[model samples]
Target: MILSKRSLLATATAFALVLPAGWAIAKEQLDVVATTGMIGDAAREVGGDLVKVRALMGPGVDPHAYRQTRSDIVGMAKADLVLWHGLYLEAQMEDFLNELSESGNVVAVAESLPRNLLIGHEDYEGKFDPHVWMNPNLWSRVVLNVRDALIEVQPESEATFRANADAHLEELRELARYTTEVLSSVPAESRVLISAHDAFNYFGNAYGFEVMGIQGISTESEAGLQRIAEMVDTIVRRDIRAVFVESSVSDRNIRALIEGAAAEGHEVTIGGTLFSDAMGAAGTYEGTYLGMIDHNATVISRALGGDAPERGMSELLN
Candidate 1:
């Protein structure tokens, strides 16, 4: 049954009170519920064996439009810590998450990023772009925030969390290096990235590529015929070769761009699908946060006449 917010908060309070009694004499693993797979991955990496993380949104799920299910509400209520990418990334869940924070250990990891570093959200006043994961270097800051959250929830395990976070941060540094190197291989004029939406703004900003999107930052923003026609004109005039589709977003508009370009006697191909707003399948390497960015960098670089390995930075992308 769909529980009202009041009932859900009451249920959470009940769970919080009784949960301690069920713990063994030994400490139990900290239970973490993150809003997206990216946040969950950070928790798992930082918390290591000390925490059990569950991501509410999985592969191909659009956080922009996702609403919590009854099961999700129950899980978050029981969780010891809840992490969500703030900055309106979880647009639909913002109010619920804010309300949930009143009683639980809830943290908006991405919101921890400094304002000066963030791109302002065009549609929403005072809100920053939520897609910080696009730039691994910037994401490193979020990883630190995750580490701090885990430590706050369970201070005794700070050593483990610190070590794990350090290792993960190193990996992220390497990912940033690799992406910068490969993405740099594209000629300046060919470095334009056109996608289903404006999810890659950070990536563009980080790597010096111009980005175009048929839809706005949120996929919920509609792409009109005029926008599509404008993009088509841009592509043809610029002699752009490839445009990308996102895993979580519909490709209808991208296809429209291609058709429009073709009608103008200019061919535009679909660059490999990018994992925007989500990662790959659960079991694959691409499902991991590192692999997700690696795949995007490799795909974008290769499609835009740059050099990147077929398998990606770690040779683990699938």
Candidate 2:
């Protein structure tokens, strides 16, 4: 028999209320449900052997428009901890997650970041950009929050979580260093980044590039013909040679930009397919948060006439 989402949530809440006080302690590994691959990677890194993490959104999945399914609700309800990137990244899941938070161990990991460090959303007043994972230095703060969350749920594993988080943060620091070096190598005039969407604003801010996206911060927003014409004009006027596509967002707009440029007698090539709102396939290195950023930095640097190793930082990119 099938049940409605509301009914399932109600049932899940009632079941939780009946469980013993130390019910989670009975389980060997903490079951963690994360809204995105980035959060899931953090949970796995910090929780290590003590956690079994499930990322609701996988490779090529756009969180901006992703709504919670019945299975997602059930999994999040039963999870020992639910980590979501707040700041409206999960646009469709916010209401459901807020409802679940009242009865479950739900936390918006990205919301823990200081507002001063966040980029303001142009279309929405008082809303900040949700893609903090783009900057390693900023993401280090999110890693701390993940560590604190893990410690809050399982105090006994505080030492382990702290250790793992520190190790992971060190790797992020190295990534920041490598990205800085490579991205800085691009000529100042050639550092403009045009992509399928506004997901790279943080990356642009970090590396001093002028970023333009065909779509807004949210993929749900449509890109009109005038916007395409304006971008084509910008590309031709600036003599921009490359533009990028995202793994999750459709490359149709990018293709439009290319065609538009060609019509204007300017040639442009696809810089690379970047993992913007999503990571690579699950089993690949690019699937990890570290690998995702590494691949982006390497590809952008190389495509924009900067210096970056073909294999990316740590020589681990595939």
Candidate 3:
């Protein structure tokens, strides 16, 4: 039977609405753009062959003060979804990323965690620390966030995404176990960790180190002379032998720390570079999220007189 023209138009409209989302999912891979290496790693793992992932920040890149370039704006604009750390971690780029949510899916995975589980920022009123990845257990939540985001975009790949997330979560658990074992080996007295920035409060909470960064949590804040002097005095008094420099952060303040301690008759050396704001070189084991944390935990352990493999707990980090 021939349908009326109005009925045909209405039928076509309903079909168009119903089929476009599925057709798009089948025709194009999800394009996911992430702000930091950690979130980028998650998208890559969870999306697998179903998505194309680009990370805006890379090795030795500081997310705290990172500003999006023209290329970054283009990438985010073209992406199916955007992932970021949030919790003011990307302080400089927060406003832009926040505004993007009005038009598309923009997720702040670290900020998705329960408030009570997050540590309060000492000075950033009403904000919580954004370094939740320091603790593998805490990072597991982020992995699931990535999985859910990917599934939202392309539901057909749900099984693959879930499986990849589960495997990655297990790896995170293993990394945590290794971190605990190695860090626990450090003598309790030598467990105070000093660094250029206060990025490891979560690490200290998870692994029993007394953490101090020369600069505050956000690198945008300056390390005052008084703060440096106080840290130097603490190092001298405790004879803390190792201080870590972060790959993304400037080492000038770290040098000041060492010089200050030396003038006071204490010798403190940089233990090893840690991947705080970013991962290691791309295509290397340290470039991955697992490797970043592994490298940091191993470096901190071996630096402070603990026993751990030179390469890392897995002997695969580069």
Candidate 4:
């Protein structure tokens, strides 16, 4: 019996399917690129095995100062869908993203957030804060927006994406609750959070802390001596316990704050390293979006005279 081309193709396909799952691979796959690791995490949750997600900024990378390398440009050009956190968080990449928007299905996930909830940029004045994801409650909204975006791109997988997004959103809600409960432990008097940069305004606003910063919203801005003196005096007079250093930003400013306080006969120490501007490494618990916030909540609560456990939210049983 002679086999025709169609009959041979059908037999080969049947054999391929019966072999193994990993052996049957497609030559082309969905291309997805997100600006930050946090956005990548959300996209991965929603996309699952159906899509590929790429983050422009990785662990310990400062988004504010990040410039698109030649490889990043190529990646963006090749992406089927690109998502970025708008609101000026990626100042350096703003122009690149704008240009990429004209060429492909590029989305600014944070743009869907309500204007009222966002804090305006200090120097830019009218611009809203780009760090909306700092608040877990606000972050949940972004996750939902991400689900919708992914559904729009791949309608066939809508059910899968929605379920994943729903599961992730539940985790985010739990994160918000945990954040509030943990922060509640900090005494009212010691509920001040002074960090190296002004990235945690939304966090403070959400959790009832008076947030102060040595530097402005943009890490590119300098912390003048006057600013340092003012914070030092505030710490000394107010008897503030500690300040925090971010993983992306240099600890130079925080070290200055500590030394200034020491010169004035007051002791100040860095409470702990905070995951700001980026998440921790992949595979580590601290690397996940939920873990990132959990770490921040635990650090801030303990540093500010609150009763917090070393292992983070009791959910982890630590």
Candidate 5:
């Protein structure tokens, strides 16, 4: 019981070697290390019992500024498959991820989307917005990326992968319809969504809303004095009632926007927190990709005076 560390390790190693065949058999699950929870969820949904998934960036962790921890690097090194959003979503870790491809199956799932479907980044040259998950229809395309990535790691599970992906896509189809039906109920002119950053362009395009953000696309890009001043002017001039904040981003910039609008006699209030770069708390209904979209659609519909169930598409489901 008081064995030295080295002796304990040696004893455990011997025990492992002497274990019964079934007990000694390794679990046949691909070790998947995904950078984002959205990707991680897809891996779990598609891979099912065939993959053990881990997400590097959890709820409220901004991927735009996230640098890999030593544990993340070690996990990725040991993983059978690796997935990231790409499209410059992980701006800070691009080089590191690129280098990983040389040694393993590191793939950028969203980057595989056709350029035509992507919104070009307004400020950055030759870059596209990475928040494709905002639109359930477009997100279906990314699901295929997850499917293919899983298949690549475990070719024998192709049937399972395809079946799970098809099911997920069908759910997305329902989600898209629900989003359209709910968001369309809002008065057309009252459809402007002001938020912490320019992360909702895809959501706006998919749902027909004019989106404005205090900062540019990447949260890494800071909002300057003039930018805040300009936004305050826009809010007052337009008489926008509700601005939203992002779950992964700081509310400091949004608070400034609120203060500035108040100073100008505009009563803009924080609408609701939306999931942007990250999903919601794990194990909650909002944690899943489906739940995340449903929550946003329901919240946006309610806050903007649209007709939607308060609990979402189905009161029983969420």
Candidate 6:
């Protein structure tokens, strides 16, 4: 059949218009960058298939002393939206986060929490401790902030993000209740939590445990001979049973405490490994924030004379 060039062009245009919107072109997925695994996990739950999320610090990496590499800088620069835990959690990356916020793509999730509710660092006047996520109830607020940020970045997907966030928040609440119930099995006198580092103040506050760390709040702080001596003295004097080692920091300091106690005829065993600064490997239950907390709660409860389930699952402890 013979056809004029103008008629052919018109037919092609009509066919293009009749195609599905997806066939026309798929929308570009939003690029999301989160500071840590916990934030990344929350973002993933909220974003689902609508966004690409990248966590700057992975499992077992400490954020307090984490220096951003060149790739991290580039990633932050390229990200469409960024979520970071503020309240001095990222002390080294503060400037970068503030710059990103000025550029209008960064959101500090912890900023949503009210100041009066936060625990203040003793040495740092007027600065609140940044470990708000230790409480799932407080963490829900951060998750909601992440959802709002995602909606702001891609308003069309607001409903999906909101729904996902609601579901995830419910899970967090349940986990919190579970943690409380599990911890209740421990006798009040035995509820002492000692670790190599003092990262669990918020956890202690939430769970009613007396927390003592060999090191200070920030891992960057040094553990001197006096600090070790003090902790060892406490261990011997109180006859404490178990001390924990954090995955991110070196266990040498903790081992020294144990040896010092042994010299004084006090026996202390490591309770179990705790995920303080980071999560477990991906795909493992410990990789998720809830799983990490559940593992710690179970291990701690059992080690401290509580009736928590062994192995944390159906199988025996590995």
Tell me the number of clashing residue pairs for each predicted model: 0, 0, 0, 0, 0, 0
Per-residue lDDT of model 5, residues 1-318, tens digit only: 133444434544555534434222126778888899999998888888888888889999999999976556556655688899899999888887787777678899999799999999987999998899999989888889999988987888899999999988898899899899999999998899989999999999998899998889999898999999998998899888888998999999899999998988789988899999899999997989998999998888889889999889768454
Write model 1 residue lDDT over 1-318, tens digit each, in one string.
345668877775665544434332224789888999999899989988888888989999999999987567767877789999999998888888888888789999988688899998887888888999999999999999999999998998889999999999999998999999999999999999999999999999999999998999988899989999999999999999999999999999999999999999999999899999999998898999998999999999999999888888977433
lDDT of 3 at 262: 92
Question: What TM-score fits each model?
Answer: 0.93, 0.92, 0.90, 0.90, 0.90, 0.88
Clashing pairs for predicted structure model 3, backbone only: none
Evaluate model 6: give its TM-score.
0.88
TM-score, predicted candidate 4 vs. hidden true structure: 0.90
Model 5 weakest lDDT span, ten residues long: 17-26
* Of candidates 6 and 4, the better by lDDT: 4
Residues 1-318 of candidate 6: C-alpha lDDT, one tens digit per residue: 222444433544555544433222224778888898899999998898888777888878999888766456556655788899988778888876675566458899997688777888754677887877777788888899999999988898989999999899888887888788778888998899988787888889888999988877778778999989989999999889899999888899999999999999999999999988788898898988888888888889999998887756323323
CA RMSD, predictions in order: 3.8, 4.4, 8.8, 9.6, 6.8, 11.3
**Candidate 2, 185-248: lDDT as tens digits:** 9999999999998998889899999999999999988999999999999999999999999999
Task: Please report how far candidate 3 places residue 91 from its true position, in Å.
Answer: 1.2
Query: Which lDDT values do the candidates have, in the order given?
Result: 0.89, 0.89, 0.84, 0.84, 0.86, 0.81
| Model 3 misplaced stretches (Cα beyond 4 Å) | 1-27, 316-318
Per-residue lDDT of 68 in model 4: 76
Off by over 4 Å in 5: 1-26, 316-318
**True-structure lDDT of candidate 5:** 0.86
Residue 200's C-alpha lDDT in candidate 4? 93
